[model samples]
Target: MFKHFYGDNITEDMAMKFRNAAVALNVQISPAQVQGYLLLRKEDPQASIDDIATITYCK
Candidate 1:
């Protein structure tokens, strides 16, 4: 979980860093999507930007 790893008081800059990490990982995800993934990761770390890309491409 990003919030857990990074903390709940995450800032916009921190969110951008996380999004950039996903992008650097070659995962095609928007900042908002990355934020969503971070929140979701709080519940499931296995849930990732790659999974989001897979679902997006499938759609």
Candidate 2:
């Protein structure tokens, strides 16, 4: 999905930003779980990365 949004050219940097943000939101979360939320950004571009990370905690 990350590849679908960012294109087949998804980069390490792109995925890494989401991975880092997820960890910041929840120290216990795994990269795989974080990647799930990262895919969501493709659906809601209005939200910032921080906002995306906070979604799991907020709701």
Candidate 3:
């Protein structure tokens, strides 16, 4: 399910980086927010993980 939504570039390592960034910022991420991130990525391929994270999780 994650593979289908996130695509191949978002590997475990990359996901861990995202999780780590969230932890660093004391942000809590949810599955729905992940879906939102995927959509945001589809719209803006150049969007950074931090930006996506902020948009989805930081709310």
Candidate 4:
């Protein structure tokens, strides 16, 4: 799913940004959970990572 959008190039920088966004959104996320966020990002590219994290995790 995530690979459909990012291919096989998930970078540390990308993970870090997602983590930071999750943090700002007050979502308790681990490194492994980032793929789920990325999946949500793929579904709604117009959404900020913070918004995705909030809607998916902070519910």
Candidate 5:
């Protein structure tokens, strides 16, 4: 799914990072979050992966 935009770079480590961050915020990652992140990434190209992930869980 995320490989579509990030190529082959979206590995377990990255997912883990996102998951950890989400967990810390008492949030969960779901399809809706991924889709929203993709859209937000498109709208904010300058945002880092961490920033995007943070926003995803926040939403």
Candidate 6:
């Protein structure tokens, strides 16, 4: 979970901000998207946010 990497101090507001940002960029932001984002963020740190958005929307 995000707490594992980002630490337990990550507030709900911060999490929501990430969700909002991802959604604003066109990603179909959801709990599943959040999980995928965390995975992809680890595997490909340089991956484009838009790419995530595309995949989320297409799926």
Number of clashes recorded per candidate = 0, 0, 0, 0, 0, 0
Could you give candidate 5's per-residue lDDT for residues 1-59 as a string of tens digits? 44455555567666566555556766557777766776767543334356754664535
Off by over 4 Å in 3: 1-4, 43-48, 56-59
Alpha-carbon local distance difference test for all models: 0.51, 0.54, 0.58, 0.53, 0.58, 0.52
Q: TM-score winner among the candidates?
A: 3
- Which segments of model 4 are wrong by more than 4 Å? 1-7, 28-54, 57-59
* Superposition error at 16 for model 5 (Å): 0.4
Candidate 4 lDDT by residue in tens digits, 1-59:
33345655665555566446656767456545555556656654335344654545622
Report the candidate with higher TM-score, 3 versus 6.
3
Q: Which candidate is the best by lDDT?
A: 3
Q: What local lDDT does model 4 show for residue 20?
A: 64
lDDT of 2 at 1: 37
**What digit string (tens of lDDT, one per residue) describes model 1 on residues 1-59?**
34455555666565565555555667555656546555555554445433544433321
What TM-score does candidate 2 get on C-alpha atoms?
A: 0.43
lDDT of 2 by residue, 1-59 (tens): 34445664556666566556656765565555545565656555334354754656431
CA RMSD for every model?
6.2, 4.4, 3.4, 5.0, 4.1, 5.0
Q: By the TM-score metric, which is better: model 2 or model 3? A: 3
Quote the positional error of residue 12 for candidate 1 in Å.
0.8
lDDT value, residue 57 of candidate 2? 46
Name the TM-score of candidate 4.
0.39
| Candidate 3 CA-lDDT value | 0.58
RMSD of 5: 4.1
Greater TM-score among 2 and 4 belongs to 2
Pairs of residues at least 3 apart in sequence or in different chains that clash in candidate 1: none
Which of the two candidates, 1 or 3, achieves a greater lDDT against the reference? 3
